[model samples]
Target: MPRKPTKGYWVRGHFVAYGSEEDSELKRAAKWDADLSKTDLKKRSAHLQAVGEQLLTLKPSLLQGLDLPPSLREALAEAKRIDDFEGRRRQLQYVGKLMRQLDDALVATIEATLAEQHRASAAQTERLHAAEHWRERLVADDAALDAWRELEPDADWQRLRALIRQARKDAQVHPDPAPGQAQRKGRAWRELFQHVRAVLDAHESPSTVARP
Candidate 1:
């Protein structure tokens, strides 16, 4: 007769025989988990549920890249269509359960993706601010042109200088009339902003020149 196979479960690609030391140790760890207070478990559940909810806000492109299980993805999609508050809550709870089943590596990847998106958004806002600051400085200070030339050596200096000069003249002629009046900036001011933004964008490869 063929030998009987060992009664065991595979863990981390190893067969853990039933009642073996490794299996006993694993059971002990589980016992510790079982001993956790209900309050602690609830808190952990709530945190995981919140992370699951964040998937709804994720961009479609980013969401598609995640290696989520079919059941969890389906649950999330259904949750979005759920108009009833109670039903949606229940669906999301299901989502949380599925999230808990995800391997730590996948969870880490999700966190990293969210962080990357956040950083990109912040960098875009910073770039816009830098362009605006440069435009103002270029108009107010003549020496700012030389500074800008150093920043973007290949930029068309003649057009930039003309735009700056016209922007300054327009500001002097049409100052912010009063607190209640609309902020009326001339065409040159807007053009200068566009120019600065273009230069900053073009320079991102060699070096980021859009600093305040």
Candidate 2:
């Protein structure tokens, strides 16, 4: 015989696992440990974002003094590694968008501040126009890409892409109901089940019926 499927919280901290006093205590301890880990994860995320922001600001200054205080430098270094992995890896989707805004703002700032540095009016205008044009392309491209993603979300060009394509094909072949249809069906089924249950419960009650 096939094993029956049962659903209960299998995670350590969940209430279902702690039916007894001893189990409850163990659950509490596990919860506290998980809380600590979550706290560390959040703190690391913040620290890494701070480091990335610092890198962005620092990279802009071509001839500025480079020395950070020792403690800050240590923090920055750790932040840089974490930022590189999580920020770059997970957040690459936002890079084109962010780069567009950053480039536009930087160009405007530079044009206002460094127009005199270019020596010739034509050179300054040309550079300014180029920067603005590049910024526009970046914004437009990002928007187009985002729209395309919405229409076809499986953009990951990896081994998983084939699996995703197959799943999409299967879904197209056997499409699921729209979101609310499932909920409506579920509610109707639940009502029918409850009515059946009530009938069964009433039949099992102490009231005796006559058989003619």
Candidate 3:
């Protein structure tokens, strides 16, 4: 750690701890206990309090045009609830922009937070993919389909139903193929398999791990 700068609030050559005050008015409070003599502490405390309030009040306005982390800015830009209205969208955008300006040091904080989420999401996605493949192989051998059916009965049933439906439809639509030929063609089964796999893929979570 570098020595605290004697000249200004910012250390000229070092990174200070987060939320450190620029002025030393607040230092007295840290130096002495809050239960000290009221008269002695009153003057310094009052001035420091006033300065703190003023700094906070002006800080937001000052930060209004500062740049933010690109990832954070992009995330904020893309923030939209499922049922978000246009007005709410605009409000969120304005809020995000304002926040970006005020908290100049928040870029790192926001990125770190998002990185954690990304890592977790990635882990979950990996787990889901593993589950899908394991189930598929299991279904292929002994009871692979049975395992899938047990895990996701609705999805499994729907896939089977769709394949049967398509087979019937194809048989009716195209009279060229023989009766059992259409069923064995496997196009309908292949389509249903592809569709089910796609649905599983869509449910996969993206990795949120931070990269250098």
Q: In lDDT terms, which candidate is top?
A: 1
Candidate 3 residue 55 Cα shift, in angstroms, is 26
- For candidate 2, the lDDT comes to 0.39
* TM of each candidate vs. truth: 0.69, 0.17, 0.29
Query: Cα miss at 87, model 2 (Å)?
Result: 9.5
Task: List, residue by residue over 1-212, the lDDT tens digit for candidate 1.
Answer: 99999999999898999988667757754764798777876776677788899888888899999988898899999999999999998999888877766666888888788777777777777778888888989888888878887778887778778888899999988888888889888999999999888877766542466554
lDDT of 2 at 37: 85
- Estimate the lDDT of model 1: 0.82
Highest TM-score model number: 1
Clash list (residue pairs), candidate 2 = none
Angstrom error at residue 165, model 2? 48
Candidate lDDT values, in order: 0.82, 0.39, 0.46
Q: On residues 46-144, what C-alpha lDDT tens digit does candidate 2 reach at each position?
A: 543443343433432421333333433454344446656766544432322222223234434433333333344444344444333432332234343
Regions of model 1 farther than 4 Å from truth: 1-32, 35-39, 78-94, 180-182, 205-207, 210-212
Angstrom error at residue 123, model 1: 1.4
Q: After superposition, which runs of candidate 3 have C-alpha atoms over 4 Å from their true positions? A: 1-84, 142-212
| Regions of model 2 farther than 4 Å from truth | 1-52, 60-67, 83-212
